[model samples]
Structure formats: C-alpha cells, structure tokens
Target: MNQGGNKIGGADSASRAKTRASGGGAPSGGSPALSIVIPAYDEAGNVGPLLEEVRREADALGRSYEIVVVNDGSRDGTDRALDELARGDARIRVIHFAANFGQTAALAAGLEAATGDVIITMDGDRQNDPSEMRRLIEKLDEGYACVSGWRRDRHDDALRSFASRIANRLISKATSLPLHDYGCTLKAYRRDALDPSQLYGEMHRFLPVYVRARGGSVAEIVVRHRPRVVGVSKYGFSRIPRVLADLALVRLLFKYRTRPSHLFAKVAGYLFATGALVGGYGVVRGLGKAPILDMPVLLAAVLGVGSLSLVGIGLCCELVMRNHFYVLGRRPWRIARTVNLPDPAATGMVSDRTAPTKAVQGHAPL
Candidate 1:
C-alpha cells in the first residue's frame, strides 16, 4: 500500500506477486522460507503486478520464498496470464480452481499445497501491499501464531467500509482477537501454528481467532491501504447479508464448539418446560369446557409436538457435534506436523529474538 493510494499494478509495481506453482513436486529439498498465498477473482489487472512485487520483496528479506496465486475461477485471462508469467519465475506457482468457490475455498486449497515455514495471505488486488508483508512476518516472528494487517484510512466506498466495520465487530467479539480489521486480506501465519481442519467458512477472515483457539497469540500492525484502480469489485453488497448470517452461525458454533451437549440440553429443557406450561393451561381450560376436547386442546397438542421435535433435533445435533470433534482432532492439519514431531520449526520472513517459535525447523533460532 502507498500513502498516495493510487492502486495500480504492473511488473514494476511494488505490490506485484509471482505465483509459479508446480504440482505436488518432491518436497523441493527443504521448504521455502516463506510462501505467499494470494486469492484472485477477476483480478487480471492487479494480479500480474502483485506477483512481481512479491518476488522483489521476498528477495529483499534475504530468505528463500515461493508465491502461489489461487485464481478463483476467474472468467478473465488471469489463468493464462499467470501461466505465462510462471515461465519466467520458477518461484511463482499458480493454482487454478475449476470454478468460483469463494475466497475461503481458494485460500484453503493454496494452504494445503503450500510448503513453507511462514505463510502469508493477501488479496491479488493491488490494495494490499507486498511491502507490508515484512511487517506481518516480523510480528509473526514475535511469538504470534498470526499477524493481521489493519488498514489505516481504507479507500473503499462508504457502504463497503461500513459493512466491513460491522463484520469486524462481530467477528472480533466471537474470536476474541479484538483486531480492528477482520476482513483485511493482508495477514501472515506461522504455517505449523494454523490447523486447516479447525477452519471453515468465511472464517478465513478470523484466522487469528482460529489460531488463538489452538493456544496461539495474535498480533496486529498498521498497514497502508489503497483504493481500487482497476476492474470493479467481484463481491459487492451481496456479500454483506451472507457475511452477517455466517457470523451468527460462527457465534453459535464457537459458544458450543467442543461441548455442544450443554447448549442442546439447555435449549431442549427450556422448550420442554414451555410446552408443559401450555399443556397445563389446556388442561385447566378443558375442565371448564362443555366437552373434554376443544380448540385449546388442539393448541396444546401442536405446541407439545413442536417442542418435542425441537428437543429431538437439538439432542441429535449434540451427538453429531460430539462425533465430529474426534474427527477434527485426528485429521491432518498444519499444526500436528509442526508441534508434535521433532522436525525443525516454521520460518518467518522477518526475525525477532524476543518471541517464542511455535514449531521448529532446524535453522538458527531465527
């Protein structure tokens, strides 16, 4: 990002990223020092330039690096252009998704394929600066599982800005990360510190929260923000509603993520009690009726069935959530490899001495 905020991209642009991906190749001797995963959706205008800038920045950091661009089923020439650029830069990798599966899915695919000690994720658009990547990496090196970029003076339309504010509040509340910007794409994560199985949904916005859930600390730094100077935004106001709905679901899941039985039992108990009250009223009304059965009895019957059904559903979901907990714990993720084994710890683009490293890969303490 630049102070002037003229968001444009070209080979000479500082924000240019290089995604030279080759399919599951041999572990490439040792993993690159840092791997950048960028998600692009109809960002042909910006993607080209962002790639170039990432290459230059990585070189300046004095570390081996690889950049992977995940083209989220762009209808533009993004795929072909990335492929063409790959011919010139072996450090760049391109992952082309078959269709638009949203940014979360695109990022998930890139993370699964990445081979690096420290991982960085940013938008393919020129808004997120490659220069700021170092800042995030630096913070990650300070014993933080993830570092998020806070866009100071954002340069988007008012509606987009306002919507993002709402989302950040709700997400911060849920994840308890308390960062100002959850939607900001500029972020860095210690590869082994994040577990993919513990992630899903638009949850990518709350990567820090997910990391914290696994006992990782999250830090934030101010990063410059730039306005869009190319094609229109791919996801517009339509995403606002979806994001709010998803936030509600995330809140519910987080509250009862591990022990859902508590949540289910509470809901069921309340409903069952309410139903009993209705039935008691019905019984009293029936005693005063000319006939034993009446409209009140029908109302009571409907309420009883509805309450029972809700209770049953809640109980069943409780079992399902518990059953899946073990599945998630046992599944393969970025954490198990970095934490459990005797392998070296993860690497970062920046080095700091005060911070504790979560996972080790045999290099000097840096």
Candidate 2:
C-alpha cells in the first residue's frame, strides 16, 4: 500500500469527532498517558493556539497529560502568552530559557521535565496538526516504542521540499533506519525507550536512530501537514553542511559507541598493511641497486611512520572513550524545572527526575 499523503478528508471528520467525544472518560489501566512537549522559538502567534488545540485533543483522549511549552528565548510576546496561559491552567507549563539555544536544546530541556508514560514532541508552529496525535498514539499501541510522523504531502516550497527529501534519504542510509520523513517533529515516544542525555546539537533529527540503537522498535504513520500560519523558517541551506557533519558523528556513535575499538580495528589494520607494503617495496627495490635516498624510499618511509602513528592515535581514542564511559560516566541532559510531576514517594517509586526550581540563567535549577 502507498503510505504517502493519506489525508484525513471531510468524511473522516465525523468519525474523528465521535471518537473524540467518546473520550475524556476515566483512563483504564494500561492506557497510554501522554506529555506533549512543544519547543517554541519566536512563535508568539502560534503558541497560544497550539496549546489550546493540544489541550482540547489531549483532554478528549481521557488520558492524564500535560503540555510543556518550552520558550526558547523568544524575543516576541511568546513569553507573555505562555505566562498568561500557564497561570490559569495547571496542566500547561512553561520553561523559559536564558537565551536562544536552538531547537535541539529546547527539546532536551522539555524531555527532562516531562513525566508521562509516553512523550509527544511537535513543532510550536501550527503546521503539525494536533488531530494526527491520535493516529500516532494508535500506532504506538502496536508494541512500538517510537512512532514518527511522515509529512507525505508537505506544504513547503520546492527548494525546501527537494532539500528535505535528499536529507531524509542520506540520514536514513547513514543511520540504517529507513524513515520517509525525518524532518517532522510530530512523534510519540515511550517514556523509557530513550535517554535524553544522549542528545546534543541538532541530533533531535536522529531520535529514531537513537531509539533503534537502544533496541527499541520504531514505526512511521502519515500525518497531516499544514502550511505555516505565522513566523519564518529558522532553517536554511547553510545548515545542511552542519547536518552532514553531525550525521557522520551519529553513524560512528551508533555503530561503535559501546565498543569503540570496533571502529579503529579495521582502520588500524589497513594502515599497518599499507605501511608494510610500502616499506617492503622500498626494501625490495634496494636489493636491485635502487638509490636508498630516492623519492620512492622517502615516500615509503613517511607512509610507514604515518600508519604506525594512526594506529597509536586509534588506541588513544579507544582508551579515552573507555575512560569517559566507565570512569567519568558523563550525562549531557539537563533540566531547568518541572511542574505537576507525580510524587515518587506516594507512588512508591523513585525516578531520575531532578528537584524543581524557578527560571534562571546558567545551569541553575529551573
């Protein structure tokens, strides 16, 4: 079946509304609770509307849910809008960053504060329809830890559409996780399936890869994509080179993160073999009365030393990686604050959730 651009038409609207109206009842045991984390950057106009839509849909689902809108240092009226919204509704919260730390950082902050059985991530722009969240959650019930949205009928310009297609193909090939659309942020993830600490830079695009690398199953569903209602796209072609560089790093991390020696082993072997061949050729030529200080001899000598040096560098890298993982135990994820989190003691379970604090600059709590 062609899974591309399966639009929800008018006929489906009545059925969808019925399904929604039937929801908002008491959640049964094993029902998937949700935490919708939206990262907003200068999206003042869309912030309030997005939250309202999410609230309506999430409440209709009859699941315990919270909408965490991370204000990514928006210079606009986004902060004011979030403050007014959060003051009235306890289910809505905001995390105000000290500066514009990019979307990935904003997402990392939101994931840390999230306390739900399942976390939903979407763009702050209204382009990602909230109605499709039900579809993602429905697919998540099929024993998949992650459900990514595919914008089959994207509404962007031709250049962006073409660039996105190329980027998706390259990322899928590099990560070995074939996804139709990696740019869509509308995805549902199991609470324990991923570690937010492993994310950095624009690595949010590789969330599916990270989940799969941890042995978690992933599925994709076609979701409705709308044109932007406000603001401009922060991304451009200039970011492609950065994405390509990050893709290479992600590939290496996924392949040999746990056993880094696997990455260096083959390279080391090749380097040593090349060195041996070049040195051996030089020695063989010497027996035929070839000049010892000839260009071939010097070049062979350089190649031999270079190979040994590369092997040494590889060993050093392996040790550094091992020490960092075993000795230091570094974790990259951080949280500024949380709201309405369940009490661990009353629940008879302790979580990695940190203590809450107010908004502040630096690594200060909240």
Candidate 3:
C-alpha cells in the first residue's frame, strides 16, 4: 500500500488489456497499485490539466495508478468534460453524480471506485499541487498509515484563513494530531488504514483525529497551495459553526479513544468531590452554632443535587457509548464479508466491493 504517492508498479487495466489480447489470462490481483482521487465540483477548467499532471507524475514514478474524477453534482459543464476525459484516457475514471453532493461524498465516491492499495485525495480546483505527492508518499516510508498535507501558505480568502486559524487552534487543543491545517484536502492514506464508512459530516477536517481514535498513526508534510484560477469555492464562512461542532465531536473521540470508562470517572469524580467539600462546610457551620439555615446551607444542598445529576448523566452517556463502541465489532477482523443486509444476495465471501460502493465515493454528507 505505498500511497503517499510512492511509485509502486503492478498489474493494471492497461497492462492486463495487452496481456489478455496476447492470449494470456489476466492474473489475479491485477489492479492498479495506486488510486489518486480528485474531488471536483465545478472546476471544469482545472480538472483536465490536473488529471493529466497526476497521471504523468504517477507514471514518472513508475507506478500503476488510476485517476478517479468525482464530479459532484456540479451545475457547470464539469461532468460532461470529465466524461470525455474518461472516454479518451484509460487511466481516467469519472463518477458523475446527478446532483451536487459535498466534497466529502465526492472523496468517498472516488475511494469506492479506487482499486489502488494507496489512495491519494486532492482538491480538483488545483490548490493542491500534484508535485507534493512525493513528500506525502515519502513520509509513508516511516510507518505512518496516513499522511495529511499541511498548507503552510494557503491562498484562500481572509475570512477562510481566519476560520481555518481558529479551527486549527481548537483541533490542536483537542487532538494529539498537531498539524495546523486540518482542512487541507491533499492527503494520502493507506487503504487499510481507514474504514471509508466510519466518516461523517464536516468531520472530514478531523480525519487524522478519527484515525488515531481507531489506533492508526498519521504524519504530516508541507505541501504547495495555489490560488483557485477557476470555479467558486464551495466552502463558505458559514462553515465556521460546523467546524466548531466537529471540533467538539473530535475532542470527545480523542478523550474516549481507548477505554470509555475513564472519561466518565474523571468528570464524575470531580463533581462529587466538589459537592462533598460544600456539604462538609455546611455541616461544620451548623455544628459550630453558626447560622444553620443560611444561604451557605442552601448552596450546599444545590451542590449535592448537581453532583448527583452529573453522576446520573455520566451513567446514561456510558450506556449510549457502549452501544456504538461495540458496534464497530471486535477490533480488526478483515471484514471477511459485508452483508449490507439489504443486498444479502450479493456474493463473494470477501467481495472486492467496498471500493465499488457509494459509501467510499460520495461527498460531504459534505
């Protein structure tokens, strides 16, 4: 799974096409070694050139790769252009969505169709430089499962930058991932490092945090950013509210990453200890002939109820978390097979179908 853009070559459609025409059976596992997923909204002007650049870069590195263009319900002519590109280039594949989804869904869709062991996701608007692939891929050599790109000098608007700065600060305070750029789209991830379905919302910005929650390590590398030459930025200032909400979710995830009980015990213990001190003070006043039915006594009574309320809240939260925590199943099991339950008849004890489904290919849900 040499994805941070490392050039690892293996069997791919082009090679297999030639091999089969020569009267030889396509060998098993003849998929591309890498998949570069680009999430495009209305970037018709940028898509073709970026796709070509990534293709050339992957080829130059001597790796077999597939470039998946996820045309996420753009009102522009982006889908038509992508369809044409897919028609002419065997290495290019297009996921034409009927309506505009979000970028996260677009990335998920590309991930679904991606057949490569290493998957690289980049913004199709051209801000994410293709050349940065090498740095990200090189970092993969150090045993990191995911390499998130850091844009040191982002070329976004002032409002976007301010929002990003505040979001980055919140994320840094909440999670162990110390990268300052959580919203950067130029990222490379090992296929097995993440469960495509385990993501949701504006939560995309905190993917590294989510990975670490599941026991995977992520690294970061500086990347190049360019101003958007075409297409409107799909992200807007309103996203500041969503990012803050996502920050809260990420913080909760990090706190309960391993055992869930510790989070509850710590908070509950503090509340109870505070209540005990207040109650003891009230008792001492009453015993010492100080005003027994004073404001201090009432405050102590309130404190005791507040502490009990906190303990009860903790219990309820623990139960809710338990249900979802075990839902992930017994740690890692290779999935052996996924039943979807709705499509139970689909065969293959271990179908190579994960990459073919909507979960990995859809955008934003952004």
Best by TM-score: 2
Residue 147 error for model 2, in Å? Answer: 0.7
lDDT of 1 by residue, 1-366 (tens): 332222111112122122223233324677786888888889888877888888888778777778877777888888777877777787777766556768876786567557787789988888888899767765555456677788968998888788888878877776555777888888887776665534444657756666665555667788889888888777587777666655655555557766767865886787677768766776766645745345655566677778667655754564454335323232111211111112212232111211324332321110
TM per candidate = 0.69, 0.71, 0.67
Check candidate 2 and list the clashing pairs.
336-366
Error of 1 at 326 (Å): 10
lDDT on C-alpha atoms for all candidate structures? 0.64, 0.70, 0.63
Best by lDDT: 2
Residue-level lDDT of model 2, residues 138-229, one tens digit each, is 76664677888999899999999999999999998888788888889999888766666555557788888877766567788888899998
User: Candidate 1: TM-score?
Assistant: 0.69
The segments of candidate 3 whose C-alpha lies over 4 angstroms from its true place after superposition are: 1-28, 257-366
State each candidate's clash count: 24, 1, 17
Q: Candidate 2: misplaced stretches above 4 Å? A: 1-32, 268-366
